[model samples]
Target: MFDVAITNGLFFDGSGAPGAIRHLGIRGGKLVAISSEPLEEGAQQTIDAHGQWVMPGFIDMHTHYDAELVAAPALRESVRHGVTTVMIGSCSISMVLSGAEDCSDMFTRVESVPREHVLPLLQARKHWNTPADYATFLDSHPLGPNICSFLGHSDLRVAVLGLERAVDASVRPSDAELRQMEQLLEQALDAGLLGLSSMTNPWDKLDGERQRSKSLPSVYAPWREYVRLNRVLRKRGRIHQGAPNLVTKLNVFAFLWESMGLLRKPLKTTLITLMDVKADPWLAPILGPLTRTLSRLTRADFRWQTLPVPFVTYADGMEFVVFEEFPSGEAALHLASQDLRSELFRDPDYRRRFREDVDKRFGPRVWHRDFDDAWIVDCPDQALAGHSVGELARARGMHPGDLFLDLLVEHGPRLRWRTMIANHRPKVVEKLVAEPATLIGFADSGAHIRNMAFYNFAVRLLKLVRDGEARGQPAMPLEQAIWRLTGELGEWFGVDAGRLALDRRADLVIVDPQHLDAGLEAYHEDEMEGFDGLRRMVNRGEAVRATLINGRIAYRDGEFAADLGQVRGYGQFLRAG
Candidate 1:
C-alpha cells in the first residue's frame, strides 16, 4: 500500500525524456513505485494529477535565505512555486562558521535585507558557531525546502582573522590564519558542505559598525588565499562558486586558469553571472564565444550562471543595490542616516560628481546611467506614476541624473520605480538560456526582497521555454529545459534532490501548463510576515497546482499544508552526494 499516490499524470522524470503517462507511489518518503499501469493497491492519500505535468520539483541554484531560513522556515515564497530544493549561502554570505554579528554584517547590505531585522534575529535566535552546529539546527527545523550550502569565504575569513583584518587589503592572512581558514573549510566539507563560495566583486560591500562599507572579506584576500582554499575543494572533488570583479572583469581569467585541468584535476567552478546588459551591448555576444572557447580549448570544468527571464528590477527610490557599484552612488549609500543622505543629495558638489559619473557612458558599469530606462511605479505625486524619469527630466529642461537626485530627496522610499537591468532583448536571452555552458539560475531568490521579484524563477524559465517554442523560437526542448533546472544542476553540484526514480526521495511538483501565462510576470507584494508592514516585491501566479516534498504535499491548489512551516517532516537538509 502506498503512503501517498499520484495518478494519471504525464510525468517527466528529470531525465530529459518526453512526458509519459505514469503513476507514482510514495512510501516512507521514497518513491516506492513508478509504473505505466495504475497501482492496484490504494493507500492513505491520493492526488488525481490528470492533466497536470508531474516533474521533479525545481531546484533553486542561487538564494540568500540564510536569515529567512531561520526567521521563517516555511520559505513559502519559493516553495509554493514548485522549488523543492534551495541552494543557500551563495555570493559569499553563509551564516555558517562566522559569529552571528559578523555573518549579519557580511549579509545585510549585499543581500539588501534590513540590518535591524537580520542582526537582532541573529543575536536572539542564532546559536550555531560552526558548520556542524548550523547543520544540526537545520536538521531540527521544519525546512520548507531541502537546503544545501556552500561554505562562504567571507564567513571563513571573518571568523579566522577578525572582520577588520579580513577586509583590510594590506592585511593578508598570515600562514597560521590561512591554516585556520583551511581547517575551517575542511571541517565544513567534512560536515557535507557543497564547497567554497568567494567574491571578487567589489560592489558587494560590508554592512555594520566594523568594516562598514568595506568590500567583502573575500575581496580583500590575495589570490594565494583562494588558491589554498580551492586546493581543498579540488582534493575533495567539490565545487567552487565565485563572482569575478564586475567593474574591470580582468580577474575572470585567473578564475579560469584555476579551473584548467591540463595536468591536474580541474576545479569545478561556477561564476555569476552571464547577462545581456544594456550598459554593454557587446558583453552578451562576446561571452558566448568566450564560453565556447573555454569549453572547447581547455580541460576545465567551468560554468556561467544565467537568469532565464527578463531582468526587470523594481526599486523603492534609490534603495537598490546596483547603486553601490559606482563611486558616486556608493557615496550616497554609505550614509545610513536619512538626514545625512538628504544632505549629500542637497550638496551641489555631490550632484556634480554624480552627473560626471553618469556622463561616463563608456565606463564599466552594471546599471546604464541612462535614467530614461527607469519608469516610476509609485510616488507622492500620483501623476508621475508610470512615467519614465528621463522624459520628465527632459520636459523640465533638466539632466535626467539631476532629476533622479531631486526626486529621491523629495520622496525618499515613498517613491517606487521599475527598470530593465538586462536580458531585455528576447533573441539574445533565448540564446543565453540555451547556452550549454551557462546554468539556468541567478534568481537571487531570497535577497533583494524589496527590489527584485523572481521567487518563481523556475516557473519563469519554463514559461520562457514554452512561449519561445510557441513563437517558433525554441531555446531548447522542454525536456532539456527541465533537465537543466533539475538533474543537470543537481548532478553538477552533487545535490541529491533533482531526479525522480524508483526509490528516490519523493520531492516533486505538479505544474498546470495552461496556467503558465503572462500572469506569472505580474508585479505584486506581500508584507514580510515578521517585519511590520514591510512589503516585499513578489511574484504571484497560479501555475503550480501542487508541490510535494518527502512524500507529503506541502502545497496544493494555492493552499499550504497546515503544518508546512511548523512540522519537521516536510523537508530536510540535503547533503552533497
Candidate 2:
C-alpha cells in the first residue's frame, strides 16, 4: 500500500519534457508510480488533484535567507510559495565567523540585523562559530524545507585574513592564511555546504566609509584563486557567483563571460541582472551583443537571473538613493543621506551643472525619475497616496523639491520617503526569460530590508510572461517555466527535491493555474522580525493542499503536521563534483 496518491493531474516532471495527464502514487514519501496502471488498494490518504498541475517542487536558486534560515528554519515565506529548496550565501556573503561572541553583533556587518535586537538574541544563541558548526546546528533542526549554502568569499577572506587585512592588496597572504581559506572551504563542504560564492561588487557601505577613513582597498581576489577554488570545489562541489561592480549595463554579463573563458575546468556561473539606472528604451540593444556572446559560448553552462524592481521606504528619509564609487563609494554613502547630501539634492544650480557635466561625458543618461515628474503612489496611511510631489507643492505653493524635502524634514532625517522605481521593460524581461539558459531569481529577500520585496516571482511570471505577451501567453511553454523553477534548478544545484521520480523528496505543489493571481492585495502584513516594508506576492496552487518534504506532510491546507523531522537532515552539501 502506498503512503499517498494524487489522482487526476497534469504531471510536468521538471525535466523540460512534456507532461502527461496521469495519477501519481506516493509511498514512503517518494513518487512510486505515474501510470494508468491500477493504484494499489489504499493503504493511506489520497488527494484528488482534479484539474490541477502536479510537478516537482521549486528550487529557488537565489535568495538571502542566510540569517533567517538560522533563526526560523521553517522557511515560511519560501515554502508557502511552493519553493521546497533554497540556495543561500550569494553575493559573497555568509555567516562563517568563529566565536563571534554575539551573533547579532556579527549580523550587523554580515546582515541587516539592527544591533540592539540581533545583538542580544545572537549573543544568547550563537553556540557554533565555524561553517561546519553552523551547518551541523542547522541540519539537526527539523526544518520545513531543505537548504543548501555556498561558502561566501567575503567571509572566507575575512576568516583567513581578518577583515582589515583581507582587502589589503599589499598584505600578501602567508602560506598559513592561504591554507586556512582552503581548509575552511573543505570543512564547510564536509559539513554539507555545496560550493563557494563570491561577489564582484563590493558592499555599498564599504565604498561609503572609504573616504576620510583611509580604508583598506578591497581585496578582490585574482582570477587565479577563483580558478583554483573552482577546481577544488568542482572535484566534488559547485560554484555560484554574482558579478563584479555593476557600473555599466553589461558589466555583470561581460565579466562572467571573461571569467568563464579563463577557467580550464568547466564550471557554472549564475549572472545577476541588477536593476538598471537608465530608462532608455534601447536598453535591449546595449545588452544584445553581450547576450549574443553568451549564446555562442558552450565552454561552461551559465544561468541568468534579474532583479526586476527596487525598494521604496517611506518611513525614513530613505528615498530613491543609488550610489557607486565616486570620490570614495564608502564615504559618499555615509554622507549621501546626511545633511551634507542636501547639497546634492537641494541646490538646483549644483544639480544642473552636475547633470550637464555628466551628459557631456557620457551623453544624456537618465538616472532616477525627474523630481518634478515624480508622484506618490503609495503611503503608510490613507493621508498620502495618489498625489504627485508637484501637485503637493502646488497645493502648498512651494517648489516640488521643497515639498519633498519638507515631508522628509517633518519625519526627521530618519523618517523615510519611498519611491517605486520601475526599471524593467516588459520586452526585455521577456527576451531574457525566453532563453533556456536563464532561470528566474534575484529576490534578495531578508537582505535589503528597508527596500520593497518582490521575490515571489513564480506566479508573477505566469501573469507577466503568460498574460503580457501579444498572444496573451508565454513565449516559452508553461511546462518549460515549471521545469526551470523546479527540476532544472534542483539538478543544477544538486538539490534532492525538485522531481516526482521515485525516492525523490516529496516536495510538491498542486497549482490552479487558471485562478492564479498576484499583486498588491497578496502582500502580507507580517515582516518576519517586524521590519517595516512592502512585499510583492501572489496566491495560487490551490492553497498548497499538502506539502511533503522527504515523504512527510510538512504542511497541509494551511496546517503544519505534528512532526516536522521527515524533511530534516535530508539535505546534502553540494560540492563542485
Candidate 3:
C-alpha cells in the first residue's frame, strides 16, 4: 500500500514545462507512481490538491545555516517557505574543521550569528574535530530539511594555522601547511562534503581584539593555494563556490579568469556570487565583459548567482556587519550593550569623527550613503513610521548623519530601521534572471537571521514573475521561474531532489495560486532563543497548503504536522555523488 497519494493537482515537474493535472503516489519515501489516471486502490492517507500547484520543494543553494542546523534544528522558518533542501557552509564558513571557540567568533563576525547561542550548542552537541564527526553530530539531531555542506576554506586554515595568523593578510601558508590543508579537504570530501567554498570579499572581516580585523583567512591564501584546492575538487567532480571581491571589478574578473583559465584542469562548476547590478553603478559596466568571459570559457561552466529582489536589512541597533565597513565602526559594533552604544553615539567628538571619516572614505557613491534609502520600519514613535532619515533630518535642520545619531541616542536600543542595501532596479534583476546562465540565489537565510531576510525568495519570485512587471515587460513565465528555483539549482548541485518524477525523493509543495499574495509580507519574529531577544525577519508563506519531505507530511494547513510527536527529523544528510 502506498504511504500517501496526492490527486488532481496541477504538477510542475521542475523542468520548465507547462503544468499538468496528475496523480502522484508515494511509497518508501520515493515517488513510486506518477500517472494521469488516479490510483486510489491502497493508500494510508490521501490529499486532494483541489487544483493547487504541486511542484518540487524549493532548494536554496546559498545559505549559512551551518551552526543553526544544530542549535535550532527545527528550521521551521525555511520549511515554511517551501524550502525542502538547503546548502549551507557558503562564503567559506562551516562548523567543522575548526575549534568551537574559533568557529563561534568567526560566525559572529562574518555571518552576524550570535556567539553566545552558537558556542554553547557547539560545546554541547557539535563534534568539531573532523567532517565525519560533524556529519555524525548532525545525524543525531532532528532536521526539518535535507542538509548539504561545503568544506570551508577558512576552517581549513584555522585548523592548520592558528586563528591569528589565518586572519593576517601578510602570512602565507608554507608547503607543509598547504599539504595539510589539502589532506584535510580530502578527508572532508570523503566524509560527504559536497564541495569547497571560499570568499574574497573585502567586507568579510574577522572579530579582532579591539576592532574588526582583516579579511577572512581564505582571502589571504595565495593563488597557488586555490589552484591546488581546485584541482582536488576537479578530481571529485565537485563544485567550487566562491564570493569574489566586489570592491573592484578587476579583482572579480581576475578571480574568475585564474580559477577557470589558469588552472591545468578547470573546475567543473564554478559559481560566484555577483553583487546586485543596481547596488553599485560601478558593477553595471562589468556585466557585459563578465558575461562574454563566461561564454568564451570552454573548460568550466562559470555562472553568477544573484537575488531576484533588492537586499534588505532590518535591525534594532547598529550591530550589523555592514556597519563595520566604516573606521572605528567595528569598535562601536562590539559594544554589546545598547545603552553603552547610545552613549557613544551621543558623544559629540565620536559622532563628528564618524561622519567625517565616512564622508572622506566612501563619498556619495556607496549604497548606504543616501540616508533617504533608510526608513524607520519599527519605533516607539508611530508618527515616524515609513519616514526616511533624510526627511526627518531636513525638518530638524541637521545633517542626516547627525540626526540619525541623535535618534539612536534618544531611542537607545529599541529603535529599528529598514535599509535597502542593493538592487534598487527590479528591471535589472529581471534581466539577470532571464539569462539562462544566471542562478537566482544569495538567500543568506541562517547567517543574518536577526538582521536581514531573503529566505522567502522562492515564493516572492513566483508572485513577482506572474503578476509584477519589469523593464516594460512582464517577468519570466511561472514555469521558467520554477525551473530556475528548482531543477537548475538541483542540477548544478548534483542532487536529484528538485524534480517530480518516479524514483525521486518525494519532496513536494502544494500551493494555492489565487491566494499567493496573502500573508506575503515580511515581519519581525523572535524565534531564536538565548540570543538577547534579537528579532529576525520572518517572511510568511501564506499560499503553501502543504509541504512533504520524503513522502511524509512535514507541514500542512499553515502548521507543521503533529504526527512526528515533537521530534521532527524527516530530513537526511545528502552526500555528494
Q: Which one wins on TM-score?
A: 1
lDDT of 2 by residue, 1-577 (tens): 7777888887788787877888877776677787865466674778787777787766777777766665666766666666667778776666666334222322343334444544455556667768777867765765666777777776777677665566665676666776777788878777767677776544333322222122222225765566556656656646556555545534564445533644454456676653333445555435544554665574655666654333232323432224233332233335534666654445666444434432243432334434444555454543656566667778888655456655554443443344444444555566665555566677665555544455455655555545654476565777877776777777776656567776665668776565454442143435563223333222234335555666555666666665443346433333323
Give candidate 3's TM-score. 0.92
Q: How would you order the candidates by TM-score, starting with the best?
A: 1, 3, 2
Give the clashing residue pairs of candidate 3, or none.
none
Candidate 1, residue 130: the lDDT equals 89
Worst 10 residues of 3 by lDDT: 358-367
| Model 1: CA > 4 A from native | none
Model 3 alpha-carbon drift over 4 Å, by segment? 208-214, 259-264, 268-272, 275-279, 282-289, 334-343, 346-349, 357-366, 468-473, 529-534, 563-569
User: Could you give candidate 3's per-residue lDDT for residues 1-577 as a string of tens digits?
Assistant: 8899999999999999989899889998999988899885688989999768899999988888887777566677788878898998888888788887777767777887766677777778655589888778667667778888898888888899988888777888899988998898898888888888887766677663533466777878887888778878878778788876655535655555644644455554445655553346566436734564675664446677877766777766565676766665765776777878888888889998877755553432234656787788878888888999889989989888888888888885567887777776766667767665568888888877767777788887887786664334677777889999999888878876689888989998888877667357547575663344655666775778888888889888888876432464477788877
Cα lDDT tens digits, model 1, 240-308, are 999999878999899989998878998899999998999888889789668768856888889999988
| C-alpha lDDT score of every prediction, in listed order | 0.89, 0.57, 0.76
Q: How accurate is candidate 3 locally (lDDT)?
A: 0.76
Kindly state the number of residue pairs that clash in model 2.
28
Ranking by lDDT: 1, 3, 2
lDDT comparing candidate 2 with the true structure = 0.57
